[model samples]
Target: MAVDNATVVYFSEQVVILISCGLSFLGSLLIICTYILWPDLRSTPRKLLVFLSVSDFLSASSYAYGVWMVFKSDSVDCVVQGAISTFANTCSFFWTVAIAIYLYIFLVKSNRRLADSWVLYFHVVSWGIPLGITIAAVALGRIGYDASEVSVGWCWVRIQATDHVLWILLTGKIWEFLAYLILPILYILIKKHIHRAHAALSEYRPILARNPQSQSPSSMADLKLTFIPIIFISLRIWSTIRFLLMLVNSPVRQNPVLVTLHGIGNTFQGAANCIMFVLFTQPIRSRLMTLLCFCCHPSRDTAGDGHAPSQRGQGAETPFLAEDTP
Candidate 1:
């Protein structure tokens, strides 16, 4: 007996989505926990990352719930999952763009304090717009059981709605597309500004010798920041392509490989962020390693390392926002 195409697609989509969402949830949760546990890490940039992780956590958990609800075929649960996932996922996109904008202001504009002032506005836009769109989508009854013909093992805008395309764009796709456009442009500008700043600093190197505290931005930090847009676009482009194919009613949209890729790409964002910002960040990783060492060896003198874990609340340097430190 041979397995049919539909069976293959269904199984692949379900498994991939479930696993990806699980990883996303875990990754997002870890970021959130790290933020809460270490007050010193709560710099402006890290706060923005925490907000993004919050949205990712909700989106991933809701997607996993949507997968479970698929089995029950419960219409109400499907709608709820669709609404929550849409709201949270859109917020994630907004927060990602917020991070990019914050970086641009901090790096290019060179107004660090003023850049920090935008945190309130960032919260309002990132959370408020998504909430409004989700409410409108639910009011119009546009979100429900997105059949296997469209979604991977989750609920989203119903395929049956007359305005489903509009709802899809409003709920998530528009913001995602905007993030794709905005993140790279902003990061590129920041990179160019950093390079220019470095060139200018080189010119003043001898004069700056009198001021030992004067320092230029970290090129390594710029390199790490550059990865933000790359990872986001890489993990999200598949879903965008799938959506375009679906819009054209292309048969390739239903291909198991494409569907699996779409599911994994759509759900892997949180994990990608974890890998980029948390594990790859020197400050956070070093702190985490210290904590782990302390936990594993209770008798060891943590203070002997010259950085006591208790001092984490004293606003230590995070340098995650492309500051002087690398």
Candidate 2:
């Protein structure tokens, strides 16, 4: 017998979600490990990245677990998975916005101490609000297995809830939408500020003479920041579209291709972040490469040790994470 389209779509969505969540989990884990292994890489920005990865790690893992328990829709584990995913995913969105705000304050406003002063606030808002929302959702009995009609292949808000829309907004969608709006505007403002700073520097050649390399790293950092919002928006737009369709009770919301795309997009954020913040980042990648090379060529240990003294002195003075300026 030929397989029906519904069965084919369901199987495809499950496979895509599993693979995407697996990649995201591994990528987030790598970032967490990198942070733990290298104290030198623990700058303010990198510290924020580690926190973001932690949330992504939880979000992706919970999502994978939800997919695994998709058949057990009414089980307690299903509700637990839904709750955890909601909290962690919301935290991820908040942390992303927090990073943007940190960049704006540090680079655009030139606030050198904002990271130290504002990190507590960032944590309280990013983690605390999600915790509160998740608790309320659980208390109200909103989280459970959403069937294929509502979700791709995971647990989330119950379709039968009288106030499902309200819970959805409180749990995840509201923050996701806010991030979509806030990130682009903040990044654009930061870019314009950098341009103005560069223009001013060009007019005042003496400043450049004093510190010729002052703006180079900032420019490079700006280039990296430009990709962040783009990656986030691209990966998230599919799910957002699905959500809007569901609100209208449109048949297109259940289209297999769209469902697969939504599942992939929802679970692939951590992997995308890993590619952007780890693989493509020069400072972290260089350090990772050097460590790998040293591990592979242990026979050159003596030669490497001989230069350790000078390397240590230079490393102490070098600013590996000084890309925060404009």
Candidate 3:
């Protein structure tokens, strides 16, 4: 039995996107809830995760809107959907970069302390920059600024025209390259600096003995922060490469295999990020377990091991430290 290629693409796009978006939405919601429900999790570094989670949640919601727009097409709907998704995507990337930079300073630069003002500044830049980009693009698109709608029944900037292509190439494609390519480079550079620092410490035997048990939160946090970009880049790499291929040969867009691959890869990003954060970071996992225990045992006065939040050991830290140098 020969199945039509068109039928395969149609099925894959609909089913895969729906499932991915649904999982993404659910995962993002859980991340947000976990942060909100537990006050103990609130910290300077965790603030970035909260921001990133919000962006992912919005991204998933925007995808859901795009899926709905498939059945009900309207130009206004298309523009709105494109704008929201673009903003979410842009914010996610910048926030990821910010996290990396923070870790670089903390680990490689040996600067564990970040001022509150500095953290706030990063937050503002992450959220504000994306807002400006999205608004300008949406306004330009509505005013015949040459941006065209794209995506399989969903709305996104078209890659066909020079101006329309710039919208994505600048915001979306560049960020993908930054995360997928430049991040690993940064990781290597930072790791080398850390090794040098460790060697320097070895020269002072007495200092090392004084803090034999004093583990550096920077190292663990760096590992955790680095993994996030890798997870995101890995999940989206297939779709991103396919997109580049489409730029060279537009007809490849019609290939059902590529279409399905792109659909699954791009849509799965939020879920992948959430899963990695929850599973890889022990702090998040332990807090989640505490949350679950609290939920299950309503009569319990304390959560997980009965240690007071303030008394918890600072020895082991989450991917983001609760006691970042303020």
Candidate 4:
């Protein structure tokens, strides 16, 4: 009776996960489609949008097989959890690294480079490197793979008490720390130096009076534009920590509470980085709104009437009149 009840719960969780995944995927698709159909947006967050789409794709694809196993347990053959989890975690790690590196280069290098083939090369290396390491770890006889009644969601790999899963986990935890912590801090510190320089310039000019050295048009081109990447980096670090906690030694795995938290947290990370971050930006959001309004009302897009807003127009107005003798 207990076993049957557990299966039922697992099934319910799978349904919830699938629905969330589908919605998240739709959001990614919309962003990608906007880029495909529109030319203006191509200059904004283009590389970022690509990286995010790829990450969500791998993460979602890996989990789908695991979700399937919950419904048809026997259909899961060899360590599906191991394989899928491998892809998800790797993309989570490697791709996060790639983004950090890309951002840092964009900031310090002074020239943004975009080419059609760049995305293709990025996909190959980012996907290939971690995949090779994952396969090697299993094949080297260092880590064993098997399915256990411990969880239905894990189709490919689940580490038992004796499985030394914690050992493999600890190594990853260390590497993840290097990728998630040190690199972001370095980027922020470098950004601070640049910010300080710009703030100094604001002293000599009125346009920058309130805040001259806009973090935008510098390290970040727009405050609204930059917010998404900042959020992505923050979430990447957060998810890395949660992943470490979910490893073999975690007693939380046995808790219904931990299991649900793990599933929800993972899903949330995947969805936010792909959807909310991409769509909430100034350019992307503008394009998305235009697309939606055009599809529905068709005649209702007045977002870019080609006039700057009143406040900006006022800011541009000069206070210098034909002055009395200085």
Best by TM-score: 1
Clashes of 1: 0
Instruction: Report the number of the highest-lDDT candidate.
Output: 1
lDDT-better candidate, 2 vs 4: 2
lDDT of 3 by residue, 150-191 (tens): 244456764333565577665577776777766677666666
Q: How do all models score by TM-score?
A: 0.86, 0.84, 0.76, 0.64
- Residue-by-residue lDDT tens digits, candidate 4, 1-326: 12232323355666776665666566556656655664443432354555556666565655555655553232334444455566556655656556555544444443346323355565776677657756765564333232322333644333433544553453244445666565556456545544655555331243333344632443222342244346545544433444455443354444544455444444445566544445444344555566666678856656544322312322112110001000
| Winner by TM-score between candidate 3 and candidate 2 | 2
Query: Residues 186-229, candidate 1, lDDT per residue (tens digit)?
Result: 98897777667865633234323434453444344556767888
> Ten consecutive residues with minimal summed lDDT in candidate 2?
317-326
Best-to-worst ranking by lDDT:
1, 2, 3, 4
Candidate 1 global TM-score: 0.86
lDDT of 1 at 21: 96
lDDT of 3: 0.60
Clashing pairs in 4: 79-156, 80-155, 80-156, 81-155, 81-156, 82-156, 82-157, 208-212, 217-221
lDDT of 2 by residue, 1-326 (tens): 11121112366578779999999999999888877865555667667878999999998998887666564345788888888989899999999999888878866777758645898999999999999999988888888856644456677887667788788788888898999999999988877776678655332233334456744535444566577888899888888887788778777877778888878888898898787777765545666676667799977665444433432332222212222111
Q: What is the number of residue pairs that collide in model 4?
A: 9
* Error at 316, model 1, angstroms: 5.9
Per-candidate Cα RMSD to the true structure, in Å, reads 5.2, 5.2, 6.1, 9.1
**Against the hidden true structure, what lDDT does model 1 obtain?**
0.75
Candidate 3 deviant stretches above 4 angstroms: 1-9, 71-74, 114-117, 142-152, 158-162, 196-226, 300-326
Poorest lDDT segment (10 consecutive residues) of candidate 1: 1-10
